[model samples]
Target chain A: MSAKEITVALVGNPNTGKSTLFNALTGLRQKVGNYPGVTVARKSGRCDCGDGLIVELVDLPGLYSLAAASPDEQVVTDVLLGSLEGSQQPDAIVVVLDATNLLRNLFLASQLAELNLPLALVLNQADVAHEHGLKIDTQLLSQRLGGVPVVLTSAWKGEGIASVRRAIAEVLNKKTKLARLTWPAQVESGLETIVRAVQADTGRAPSMADAQRILFSSDAHTSNRLGWKLSQRETVVRQARDQVRAAGFNPLAAEPLIHYAHLRKVLDGVTSGGAGKQGNAAALDRVLLHRVMGPILFTGIMLGLFASVFWLAKFPMQWIQSGVDFLKSVAAPALAGTPMLQSLVTDGIIAGVGAFLAFLPQILILFLFVGILEDSGYMARAAFIMDRLFSWCGLNGKSFVPLLSGFACAIPGLLSTRTIEDPKARLATAFAVPFMSCSARFPIYALMCAAFIGPLYGPGWESVVMVGMHCVGLIFAVPTAFVLTRFILKVKPQPFVLELPRYQMPKPRDVLWRMWQNAAEFISKAGTVIFAITIIIWALCYFPRDAQMAEKIRAAEPALSTHELQARTQAAMIEQSWMGRFGKAVQPVFDPCGFDWKITVGVLASFPAREVIVSTLGVTYSIGKGAEADSQHLRQAMQEAKWLSGPRTGAPIFSLAAVLALMVFFALCSQCGPTIATLAQETGGWKWAAASFFYMTILAWIMAVVVYQTVIRIL
Target chain B: MDWLIIGAIVGSAAGWLIARAIKGFQARRKGGCAGGCGCADKIQPPKK
Candidate 1:
């Protein structure tokens, strides 16, 4: 630890603007959302407090109390006590309180007062309180809290941030500790007993705050942390609860009752007026959260967002395609003498990159809508709506956040399962999270829709198909979770408790920043992973050049043009190449799913990451080809593809059934390597990961085959 | 000569990709996010 650096922990209840304030203090773009559980891990950044003093700010997960009901809450409890491994006790604490709802927020602030650590109270959302016509007397509150510094802040607007920094510096300089509340003598005695018992068990006396936590918490999280034997801890806890009963108080209800009573007196006259008349939020929620209308509105919003993505991104996609074609045209002539180089540059790199990049605008637009949804506070309501559906399946509303996050990527979504208190529910949610149709699967759906569905059935059907593909995974995921929770895990139903934040207009800067970040990430993957995969696929499809194959084709068809002879030779060579042979060997397995050898090869090559399928198809179709210009685009190449063997020989390979089947397979398959590994870590074994992989793979195959056969029969 | 050059470029790409995949697998096995989704850095444990 540097002499000039002091660590301050930011603690608050969920949706109290703790993360927003953390971002403001550190100037780092930590993920901030209008809902709770958005931040499930500890994040820290340094702030220059101006005067050669650097403050290391640790942003802990949001929790209602220090009872540690969930894994994320345990992190906060562990960090505050300096018991978390590799972390020191914070030098000071900044307790963020929702200024408009101080009475509820002060419950957490009251508990922190007993820690005897230097503290500052940030009445965040001050702007909201002001707009609500609520007035807080900071000086009175500070005086009541034993001279601790108090500052008002509206973090999202960057209002009063400088005052917050000054308050932090002042609290540290003055070493101002919050005034501790007086507990009932009986409760105090019970706490003393637990404190002594803990000291005897662990050979160290615990702080009063820790003693209170152990005595009052219904869960064994505190004793478990102390490494106490279950039998011993239970006996000690029972004895302490008996003491509380002697004072006519239930041990479970005693802490909140005592704290609230004391806080009511201390905060008397510190706040005046209320937001009054329930405001616009209440009026809006009446409609948005209405039983019948909420779900219908949600469906409509989802459809509209996806339709906009397809309709809006079409122009940019065409521009990118044209640019790629131009580049290929210029490079083809320059390297005409070197056929291999020409193919590698024009067919492998440019085509592969272009195919992937054309979907960038779609990905960006989708993220922009998601960002607005998240920032507007509608995500919580959506979760509230989903809870009714999830409860029957043995999961709760908390699982919805992680499931929603999975649409962005499964890694963080799996990690966010820490917020679910029920072990069985968490595991079930983690198992189903990978099936949320992540953004990596978006390009495949977009390409299939654009190449076939759009042109055939118009943009309306294209948009519907795009939305349907996104829903395919969720449609399957719910049933999987139901079976796991009911038949295997037998999870008990848990209540969904969520505090909905006020609805606010989406911040344009944040939304655009999110879009830009996601777009850059997509571009980076295209340059690296997609680039490498394309080169390898191109090589595999272009090797063992046979000059006699062209001659044989020319001799067999005397009327063939030179271009036709070259195209025939290239196709035959690809069928004979290493990847071609491998794909053919595996093609039988996917034949029932309406997949040709080329599609099978692309699917196999994308096992490491799903998005590589686009690049793989690009390289497979473009290598060793002449500049026909018409077939340069990936969509054109796919549309022109035909089956070379079997009873369906000479028929178009990508029928509507086949295209839909391909999209279904990608949507359901557990193909992402990192997602599988994350599942292993979260579930505490590789067995669960293995089961998920095999189960999803078989399920995807069966579903694809079913779609293919049913659709083909109908057609 | 063009065949040799193409083979070298392809082989090098294959070799590099193989090494990267192996490294990523090992990292993921140890509970690190190698998802290449730009979240690994953000999701890390608190600094020592």
Candidate 2:
């Protein structure tokens, strides 16, 4: 299997460690896409280099230079000038830098050594640059640069990653020349007649670092991504900016004054010492950046990360709810001799993909506490302690890391509001980080807090009503980010600057590879969007095929009571199919919240995700009693769901005021469907995801008719 | 056998509605997201 490979890439700058040396050279393999039409992220990974060769790597995103101005630095300057589309070019180039910010990471390794290519460097906090006393000789910075290979790594003391894989396999097995540097005879006599008029109008040669950056990069989209010769490359880049301003330089500051005067003669005696004051990251950023104990220690670390995702997913959500009810009672009597293969194997693939993979231990313990609060930098000091409450909502602190990644989902909190530069505070932090509560509303707030608020409020007020219904999306994401950035996206409030890095100690394999890459993208969308919305709500409640309500429930089953003949033949095959006649023709638009047509067909088949309404109420109450979801027989058929007529006739339909009006209609709705197709692709518009799904479905039906008429008038 | 168990539940609900209409025609030809949320980067393409 030797179809040979090389690629390389891994550039750096932002909190260098270049994704901990591409997760210490591709650990759990790797992938993470993007960079085509550009929301940037890219990632990639492969790494064999244990000789049979096969490196790949990629990584990219973090920029600092190669003069790219955003669209994630024009996909890291069109994938390091291989010119991006379906990428390839990167045959070498490691870069990585940051030995305690070595001269602004050597101005992006001197603009990636004038982009000639086959580079290597690394440096990476060589033990926080020898714990600040700094030394960094690396064989006199690789013999004053010409023979590149620098290394001296410390990706947090995993020391010199085998001298950065034998200096990227000796800069991909040698023979790469051009290290000339010491330029500036007014930028080499203004790039020698625009590098010989871009090598006599592009017959090759023009890469004197793309003829000294198209003579002073006035960034005409990086001179049409350096293809050149548009009208003899803008009349030889305006006659080499009038001969580099008649040799006195400043052809727009002659490429950062001749790359910091040839990095001050190759950093003199190749860097020596004198650093000191890291006084324990400024005395732990003085009380984690305190101004009155930093918003009370960032609201006691976000109420101990949402009360330890319901007290550490209560014994692994009861051992993944008794291993999805012992694989639905061992596929119920081996598909009990077919009632459409026992309703497609215990209600369409074991209660709609095992009730969304029993919230994979509360999504890997809330992505292992947001991957150790974003790898120990205390999530940018919780966006510097929620930048004074996201600056009274005109947003700042870079819209607090996409409103703290909408608690873990608003489509990566609307693609991390592309790190908020301010298209009206990134569309008012992507229309207020989908009002937060994400881990797909943690199993619809853990199966309505364990079959209706933890056995009548026990597990300590069922984790304080599951951290106040996951703070109903941070209490309506702070007055909907202050009335959508103060009167619908007006936006002027920018000031956020943050930084706060130094707090190292996080690597438990980068917090279990970011909690198994966000709990394997929430258990691979429980096999494709919760197994195709739990088999189209188990084929709209198992078709219009009632078979005479299974022969008057097997001739009124021996005076009923196999739990009332499996609850009156699963409530007369859910009041005769088509999802109970479209949940009784939208049961008077969910009749003031006390929903019935089985909680309005599990909130109309969980509009494409909020944990597919607990496996569509475990496929309308255990179809053939295979016990659809977290069984205790579908929580005693939702605690004997009743109310067949008006004025709450026979009581029960999960009472406690219809399970706190179905957890405040799933903590204020707009029932998912990929968070309204990622708010119509991050607000270009389906009129702001149809005004955020008709203002959160009329604020989840007026807060579930004021929490089910103020808790049925306080009981 | 009960019409091959109603032809394997109508061929598993017609292969989950033709893979959800070929995943909403590949998220409307990449106007993006059908990768049900952890987007895995590169979205943008809609603004013309």
Candidate 3:
């Protein structure tokens, strides 16, 4: 809003390093994922473009053309045409192009040239172009595009950034707009008639670019944006199409055909290069993308990633556990007088937070590997491999990223469904995304595996169980998607067209940043939502303390050891508490799954978040003073737990069947509140979200019972 | 006195959590993200 400030928009094709350049120029650490569609919305930041000139730089979503096809692309088209409400008409445009692929990249630039905005062309990825032996003549390119400023930049390497900043400053100050392309008389006349018709209909004249968009768009997206209905403008639009047809072009294809023709001439001698050595990448793709070998490699990579997360994070998890125990030891005596206060701080806050934080190391490691895979261009190949499997279920390769993102969290995964253009496909993918075993569920698996599976079987088997638990949801998700897309939704199959970026070394800085950010987010949630839930659960399990419970226990077992007596008293009080009564009431329903009242309580309390079960168990099982109430202790407590009542009284509660059943339930159940809310928003109503919830819960319960019953008999 | 203090502490924690839950429910009702996962923050409204 300042007179001295000018807004410049950064627009480019997907995967052209526009975000990287935006980060470099503005000094903002906007996430820079190596894949396309990472940025789904416009992000703006301020930069001092020298001479005391403050530039407000807006980074728009990457699009191939103004003829937008998806919502994400429509955002860019709307912003560029100044039609998006509350968005400023940019004072200038910065067209960021990939230096290695000038011909294709220039097509978009050519369309922007027609907008008559002050323009600067940034030939980004200069280093890659140079390595590929590409030589672009900036001088000739500038002259060909009406002497607009052109600068070469390797954004990731911070090379030529100063030149880019200077070029932007020059364009803003001089108001040097790029020369517009002259169209053939037939096309020009057709566009003019459409413009006149629009003005007459709305009593307002539209810019020529808007007129062109309305005349040539394959759909009614542009017309809708102009607030003109098809009934109002169908005749003029048809007349314009007739003129375009007479000009020897199809109305739908005219814009690209004309723009490319102009671009071909404009770049006649402005650059030269063979498309670099794809030899290395092509050879890797042979095995990585092979029908048989690719899936094998993907499975191997995922197994190794999970195993590494477990093995590498073991030490840090122990350290955190120790820290938790130490804190409890220090606080127990300090709040000893107020038994309730001691219980709240030690059993509720510390135990819950510690149990969640213990898994932080594993979560961080998982994020690190995910970031590396995304940056190394292997994710696209993974999606390519998955396309075959997904196709049978009517989902395409585009759903792979959203599903993969679900492994980290489901909210962003649901948001990323915007990239899938087919409404049925998008809806089905969103419905299945919550079944992807997000990191929140990892704590449950880790606790279960480490406590029961690892100690009993061995670490190697533990790793396999860990991997299998991660896959349990995915295994169910495929058929769930199949049912939704093929039977219920009857979604038409869409071809998966993905451009695989050239493989490169993963940048350690970006990878580490992603890991740190995700880890911090995990910690933040633990301190807030998980913390609050734990306190409430603790209160539910702790209050209405029977004043004579300890006396009664001592009278019932007069010869018991001091530790034993205290443990009995604590157990009795908890059993008589509010949560305990509710758990007992629900225990019969889960009895077939081999879950006792305490396990049932954990399951029921964790509906808000799957991770809360770990903390809930931590609080539920807290008995002795200054007990080692970390995950390790919680695991020990679970192992020692026995069926207190029922036909199977005094039997060990956490049998192999029970552990596997619990893990399976958490894997398949739609337990996270945020995920359910996101599903409702993404699917456009609460109907599908509610269906997903009830269906997944039912399936999980049935599957859990089957696992428990079958495993118990086998054992 | 200790019992009263414990009651107050527990009551305050429960109150804060309920308020947060209500706020989250209202946000989801309004078609906004439920807030913990950082999606709501990343999505900024278009500038005027």
Which candidate should be chosen as best, given DockQ against the real structure? 1
Q: Residue by residue across B1-48, what tens digits does model 3's lDDT show?
A: 877876787777778877887887777765556647766666654555
Candidate 2 residue lDDT tens string, A190-263: 78887776667666665666666677776666556555647757776787798888778768677777677777
Candidate 1 local lDDT, residue A214: 82
Best by TM-score: 1
Q: Provide the RMSD of all predictions against the true structure, rounded to 1 decimal.
A: 1.7, 22.7, 2.2
Instruction: Flag clash pairs in model 1.
Output: none
Candidate 3 lDDT over residue span A549-653, tens digit each: 878988888999987887677778888899989998999999999999889999998887788898888888874222444234677778888877778789899
Candidate 2 overall Cα lDDT vs. reference?
0.70
User: What is the Å distance of residue A386 in model 3 from its true position?
Assistant: 1.2
Interface RMSD of each: 1.9, 10.2, 2.6
Off by over 4 Å in 1: A1-5, A629-631, B29-31, B46-48
TM-score of every candidate relative to the true structure: 0.97, 0.35, 0.95
Residue A65's lDDT in candidate 1: 82
Model 2 Cα shift for residue A192 (angstroms)? 1.8
Q: How far is B16's C-alpha from truth in model 3 (Å)?
A: 2.6
Of the candidates numbered 1 and 2, which has the greater TM-score value?
Answer: 1
